[model samples]
Target: MVTFFEASLDKISVHHVGNQSQDELYALSEAPLELKDDVIPGLLMQYFLKPFEKSNEVYHLMHSSDDLALNEVHHFATMAFEDESKFHEASEQIAKHLYKVSTHPNIKGGELYVAYFNRVQIEGNPLDAIGIFKSENKETYLKVYPDKGGFVVDYEQEAININKLDKGVLIFNIEKENGYKVVVLDKTTGGQDAAVYWKDEFLQLKVRNDSFNRTNNTMGIYKNFVTQKLDDEFEMSKADKIDLLNRSMKYFKEKETFDLDEFAEEVISNPEAITSFKNFKNQYEEEFGYPIGDSFEISDNAVKKQARVYKSVLKLDKNFHIYIHGDNKLIEKGFDDDKSMNYYKVYFKEEA
Candidate 1:
């Protein structure tokens, strides 16, 4: 049935060509003739008919039709193409290439590596796919599939092992020079001002003043005086004295010292007290080096109370800087009363 249908169509085309004039034949050579009806004799004459017998125009028409048919076939094949199948096939070929590359003896067992795709537009459409893998030696290979868009090539460093279940996944072998060692730092808790210092192979923390307060609330003793005024007499009632003593004790127990510079700024604004208060202030300076703030209260029924909170400082060697992750938390009771906590695991990477 198919052969008969094709033969009938062919016969109609030939009859149409047999009846055409020389001018019509030339026009048909420039463009394809649109068949408007299925009348066998009409189309054959329009396409195949010619003024001269055994004209070369007949050959040109046949060639033109053949070229058109070939183009249509190619278009249909490409339109029916499946990207998933191409991806699977490309992945298999990449696996084979990786396997060949891994057999070399110089490859390392746990180094991370990547593969890049250099081809574009396969089978008439854009071929943006990549294949990622790990090299156990220069011969053993493991594939890594990213759950994102983009061709599968161009894997690098941490991205190479992001999908691996085992930490021991082979990153690369010693034979390949494309892989480099990577250092990943911990991004858990702490503020950006918090830094790490290396001492005897151990990573120590050197927190900033604000970050220190966020992690340690001991300075709450003097954070209550931002809005209150104190009397000149320095005398306190029984209850006020008790409150002062309790706060003082808590401050000393928590910080063991106070910041005197911060204290003098908030209290004793009189220049005359410089001589006498100098000695008392120096005592705190000797311990904490600086004062963050002072707390004072006004009272109608009794004497007012006051106290001071000091700032903290940390010193470290030159090889390290502070690195805080995006998800850290800062706790604060009041001004100068703050603490930082590491709720998640902290990671440290060696600086190269």
Candidate 2:
């Protein structure tokens, strides 16, 4: 979703925000940090931008009143984007707002970094962006140096892991009226209770229902229908379920556009099952209060990402696991009355 191949770090402010429920205070820097080393900028860019390289979901800043000017993070980001002089001060406001929302007891106090970036690439367009990051977890590292002939182990120092960003959001300069396009990551949140404050309360993000998200969500819904809901309404063996999942993935991979009716006839191929599946998809929209159109363009990136988690394994007790990939018809499930045991038979023309 984002890259920094042509990006440069313009300005950054560091602050310490504490949990409000524990009466911890927030400390802010008066000015932005001076980048003394040229290599330091590159490392900072990696820390800020690398996590978002594989992300496909995009979001926008929003408020309850539907007013863009009232969103704190969006407002501060706008200020910095419009005038470079306001970057440091805007960072201060962002830190304060984060402190105000860190009210959950499980929320840990940590270092917050608000940075202004230039020429950050999103969707192949190099646009200016504002990045807000927080490090809530740390690890101890030991230094080994040469002392005489042998190396000496030095004292331990606690530091943040650049590869493990706990929380982050990158707001692009485009789409000002509909809340600037945003991408986010949060790795250290312990529970949903504490998780909402970061993306929901602090940043106030809404998932952009574009091709990527629509494609991703639709596949997810179908996967749920096959793996979870189908068993309640119909009697389907594990092999049948795997076959259905395989068919769904095949349809997505082979087609450029997705139509509900087409998918049902091609993948499900049963009148009653198709109606049940469509109703299940509709329930998700109604329950979640989101609309998914009946047809839309498919996103290959979303399909690839979703494929990683789709299960193709069928486990039989603790003894064996059948990996169903090519043809489900080749496997057969049977019960032996004499031994009173369940068994599966496999058929293959050749063995690797």
Candidate 3:
């Protein structure tokens, strides 16, 4: 299957790529060096076809079919290719940086592919695209140009396809950890904002800092704790759920690091509850194949991101919040003619 597309990707020609940015490029590149050539092909296939978890960083590129941000990409790409010189300059700078990355001793080099697309039509709309793909287990960087040619791309793979490219750049694999990083320069509306995506230890740190990954992981544990640890004899009031979420997020906000013991002491401070939490955490680690560590840095962004997950609500006389874990099935909204007000009916298994 890849063989059919390989020829198309190979057809795109390489352009002039940058200098000085060479040293800066090292910080941005990440692809493992030792993987077999076949490994990369498989990874690429998975990236294009597999549905990424919502929490994954690459979810937008992998799953988003249309959005304003995506449209902006097409606009920028169109402005870029309009002026042949501008297109060449941007393409050249990218190539130069990539070349530097390839030659760097530490960048266990891998194949790099930069494909130019005038525009890809989606849902009766033409959107330009520049695909900066590294044939490795890394993030795919996308650049969308404004409408130029009216080419409809039914699938994402079609846009990233190499064989159908107007121009391309390929660098052989040298290191697996450092492949090709994408830099998008959009000078379309005089606001020259460039977005760059690179994968490395640093990028992972950034992801951690956002607590994006943490929230996702912690949310899962929280749900399990609620389901398994709390006995049916003990009915969890909305207050209990609120306290749990508030304290959990408070720990992330106030603490410099995550200590499981410290978290239990400060947040889930109740002795019996803490014991139950510890048991749940241990069982979760054993069954789920990952340790809930004693320490980790707290991310404010993550706390904010998980505000909805916490869903702590303040109740009023006639109305009370029906906070849920993003599931519509858990609650239903209705209107009352007797009271002439709206109401929510919560669905949960209550213990007598």
For each candidate, what TM-score against the reference? 0.15, 0.95, 0.36
Cα-based lDDT for every prediction: 0.26, 0.92, 0.42
Per-residue alpha-carbon lDDT of candidate 1 for residues 55-85, written as tens digits (9 for 90 to 100): 1100000112334223321222122222433
Best by TM-score: 2
Ranking by lDDT: 2, 3, 1
Off by over 4 Å in 1: 1-201, 211-238, 245-282, 289-352
Candidate 2 structure quality by residue, lDDT tens digits, 251-346? 999999999999999999999999999999999999976798899999999999999998999999998888999788899999999999989999
Off by over 4 Å in 3: 1-212, 231-233, 314-319, 322-352
- Deviation of model 3 at 107, angstroms: 36
1 or 2: which has the higher lDDT?
A: 2
Q: How good is model 2 by TM-score? A: 0.95
Best by lDDT: 2
Give candidates' CA RMSD values in order.
33.1, 1.5, 19.2
- Model 2: number of clashes? 0
**lDDT for model 1:** 0.26
